[model samples]
Target chain A: MVEKDVIVNSDAGIHARPAMMIVREAMKYPCEVMLIKDSVEADAKSIMSVLGLAIISGSKLTIRAHGEGETELVDFLINLIEKDFRV
Target chain B: MRKLTVRYFIEGEGRIDLQLRLYAGEGGLDKEIKYGEINRPGLALAGFFDYFAYDRIQIFGQGETAFMNQLSYEQKMKTYSDFFSYDLLCCIFTHDYVPDKLFLEFAEKKNVPIFLSKRGTTRFITLFVHVIDEIFAEQVTLHATLVDVFGVGVLLTGKSGVGKSETALELIERGHRLVADDMVIVKKIDESLLMGAGSEILKHHIEIRGIGIVNVREIFGIRSVRNRKRIEMVILLEEWDSAKEYDRLGLDDKKYSILDIEVPYITVPVRPGRNIPVIIETAALNQRLKKIGINSARELDEKIKKWIMTEGQK
Candidate 1:
């Protein structure tokens, strides 16, 4: 698994909109991924639990990926978050 | 391959038998029955309160409808809607399910076999037409390769020179019946079942390196080449590779998804000395064992784990 930490910066604070975007990206990559926040692990591809976290700005979230194309998936997610999750 | 069939019961007058294969309906048994012919049968108008037995009947709509043509389409249809007293009726959705008055009446008379689908006109016709045929299809199971190993039907697959033909030849020699050779045309009658047929181009024929293409039926006779077989398992043969690490423990149950359905896949690495036919038979048996809730590989793994646990305790 490739793990990386990113701080939530979007105004929505990783709510439904951003969670759905992450789910869409995760599905495109053939890898098992989980998003961890404050010791709680939520399936990154699931929009419901991700929204449950209610991650506010500056909350550091660790994204871990495993399986085929896990490294590339980490790079892609990193790029997506670094760019402030534009889409 | 065993072809699955569906039968639909329809309500019509003089028991105007119309065979229709059932597709899903819109609501409950209370939906309108839309048939190709609008003309209502006499019994539909008279109501089944006096004398009726079977739930529905099957008719050949594509054939001559001598009785149906005698009365006006609207008049015959009225026999069901205006005259018949039943709330629901069986309907034969031949080719279409649009809102038509005559069709609705007949459906109201019979209480079962209501047809409903969101499919357009042409698709409904093609599907229903086949359904009718299936209900009346001649009952005959053709010859085919049938092996009861591991409880799953394992169909060997490979391109020419990939050794499907050679593997099958060896399998038959080992006392297994040949289902189909060269081309296995699979058909999805429903979920959970898939059947295969040999293509006409290479039916019962196997090509060996020196012997060229030879007809298994001609050489092995009728007792050898089977006409069809139910495919419960699939074994794909690929050219052997020293670099490719094959699954040895039988854990992980590698799955090869075909036509949206996942089947347990065992890729046999092909080489000159490898006895693929024997290996594939074992794989088919293993899959069957798994289906019946007995996983030998998992059981062995558990046994090993228990041994390790005992050693640690000591």
Candidate 2:
């Protein structure tokens, strides 16, 4: 298992657009990816789960992944949030 | 686990029929309720503080009220001063019995909330306990679909894009009710029953690979969807692996544990030409039969053993 915590610096937090981007990026990996906030785990591949977290600016999120290529998947998600979900 | 505060309880009073009116101590509305069981504080009021469960929501019925009414001003002051010394959750007076002026004064001074309910002592306790139990219930969010088939709640679980939604859609078309799709919030109620429901934003909506999000209630009418259901079985839909051996005889029972409760479980391999929905309906019916003491597999085995013995005797 691989896990990394990142702070969401986006001004708008994880609204619909940024939530979709996170889901889309997580879908590219075959392993299971999860986003956790306040001890509640949400499936990263599911758009509704990602949005349900209601993540806001400066919120701490933990990206956890298990199975093949788990470390790369976690790093990729952390990078996505750090980059303000540009792509 | 989620924390339950007095404010949440007050906000949810309408839904649970608590019929509570905040009488005093608005500042203490944020006090946490740690236990589900309520306390009467009758002994504590009489200057006996042994085994006093001050953390629980204290209930002041007629007996406690009468006792308080009989206390003299000096006695009331002494007793209440001792009572409010401990960190308490809140106090509720049933039967519309209002506390004395001194009691409310002490409550306000100590930042302890007091509420009044018109319901009788017994009725109010029943309702209060019911709500508190649910608030403290164990809960988890699962990435799956929940459907009610043949009066049985079946939880369909699997990885993403494993046809859980497709199978649930087909089940809905066949007259089954869809409780939730994609993200199912399951709560273990009363330490036995597992109730599954959807999140507020995602309830009654399903996401298909090509069709986007479809509102099941609007598309299939109200009868085709339910707000929540008790999860009695769990079925995991996985890709068909040639090397893996599946359960064929159905002799051994498989269980899936959620929140420490064991539920019947089955793994169904997904492949083309297999009617997964119909199979789920049958499994639900079979589970109902087993619940009624009619084990088809065991009964059949018993009959075969008796026949084989008769043949050997002949």
Q: Which candidate gets the maximum TM-score versus the true structure?
A: 2
Model 2 agreement with the true structure over B3-111: per-residue lDDT tens digits:
6688765685323347788899889998876778899999999999999999998999999999999999999989999999999889999988889899999899988
Off by over 4 Å in 2: B12-17
Please give the RMSD to the true structure for each candidate, in Å.
17.8, 2.1
lDDT of each: 0.57, 0.88
Q: Which ten residues in a row have the lowest lDDT in candidate 1 chain B?
A: B1-10
Candidate 1, B1-314: lDDT as tens digits: 22221221333322213333444332334333343223323443344345432233322132212344455766566543543344333444443343244444344334334454445444655655565443333332211233333335666654334766667788777766676654345555445556565544446665455675567778877776666566776677889889989888888877765555576777788998888877877777777678889999899999989999998689
**DockQ, candidate no. 1:** 0.01
What interface RMSD does each of the candidate structures achieve? 24.0, 1.5
Could you tell me every candidate's TM-score relative to the true structure?
0.47, 0.93
Interface RMSD of 2: 1.5
